[model samples]
Target: MGRTNLYIHYDAVTNHVMTRAINFEIQDFPKHYFPQNIILAESTLDFGRFDPQTNFKLIRGASEIQVYFESAHKEKMRISNWIDFETLEDMHGLTAQEIAEILYLFHANKALKSAFFYKLQNNYVYLTLPNGLNKVYYRHVQHFYPRFQRAMVVHMSELLNESRSLFFMRKAKVQALPLEIAEQVAPIFVNGLKVNFQQAYVKGSRHFVPLDIVEDELTLLTLDQAPKNHIGFIIYDSNAEKWSLELTLDRD
Candidate 1:
């Protein structure tokens, strides 16, 4: 026989309560993924947008359930259940803001201490565990969801890593530019400066090195010393928001 799939039932009408099910093998699932089934059913009280409307009605009446996959590895799937709310209080008693808050808390509770929890920051709730472990919870506020919506979890890690790498490269390039220029310009002044030299040459000028000059000097040096992966530059003048080439340097 094939392995039996696990399931859980959420009763949205009953304080958004969840029904327990038999535990099964989910050990191989990735840390960032949450596997569960979501169902929407008919509720007479008109609980508003938080309650699944059209989709809920279709699934509740359908005999066959459809599972949709979503995740980094495309392994996540959703399961659905039928919901029934008999009283208006079950639907109308909670406002949209309240319903959203409840949902936020529910997801956060499940994601505590994981990368998924950190992604919740996009949803506008800062999740933190007091002990510095992987546990997380919502802040105490009147309406939390109004401030932040749910965050996209899968690409957040990639985006953050790329951002940090780009920032580091930019800073390193900026720092290297000035140093490269100074090295190139050093030879030009070395023989001529046989006379007295003072710290004022650096401290009193009040003129700092420009990045353009550094970049130009470095590019020329690289062409002369090392031809591998070398790049040349073309200088331009600004007109009415367009640049006219002042000079172009290409390898001979």
Candidate 2:
């Protein structure tokens, strides 16, 4: 979730969708810090039919709009493992112009200072209901998409601190998130720190460090609240040889 770079690709001709990610382990006390998306995953993620109810299910600040849509499960907020922005275009069959207009009207207002979608590679792609996952709305992501892909951007430490979706920085100020928002995250530690969501603990990261800090520069990533609980994580790792799911819990 910290300093993670997310890459999305949709082959318009072949109808293939891909999302690549490299997430940082906060326990490493990474020199850099960045924002974390509302993380989710599921198998056989579908590209169509995401029913978004902007009312009751809407979670501000911490949650993104895509999390409110329907995924594989019937639950309103249940999203499949992977996501693409095509559901809006597919479900309503709205033209690019209409969809753009709607978004503009909803977002382009006085109450909101500024609203923009972010994609890693393309910083200037004209995404008009961009088909599938190619449109995370970072804008211009498509312009450099080809370049970044060809190079295979594995590390994102060179990026500026402000444009942080996933990138590294030298020192950042850590902030505490509210309890309700903090508990939702199950943190991973690279140095073999055990985390259990079942326990009573506070968990949140210094998401998006602001520039112009006069205080001490952060060396290790700090959680707003570290939890004291017991819940094991099962992580699936894959390579050319074989795929493995790490960890097994002795349950209650």
**Model 2, residue 6: what's the lDDT?**
34
lDDT of 1 by residue, 72-191 (tens): 114422221222223332344545554454445444534222221221221112222222211212222111111111111111122223334554553211111122322332232211
Q: Model 1 Cα displacement at 168 (Å)? A: 63
**Could you give me the TM-score of model 2 versus the true structure?**
0.18
Per-residue CA lDDT of candidate 2, range 154-202, in tens?
2212212334444463433222222322122212211222221112111
In order, candidate lDDTs are 0.23, 0.25
User: What's the lDDT for residue 58 in model 2?
Assistant: 17
How well does candidate 1 score on lDDT at residue 75? 42
User: Candidate 2: minimum summed lDDT over ten consecutive residues — where?
Assistant: 206-215
Error of 2 at 215 (Å): 28
Task: Report clash pairs, candidate 1.
Answer: 37-79, 113-134
Per-structure clash totals for the candidates: 2, 20
TM-score of each: 0.17, 0.18
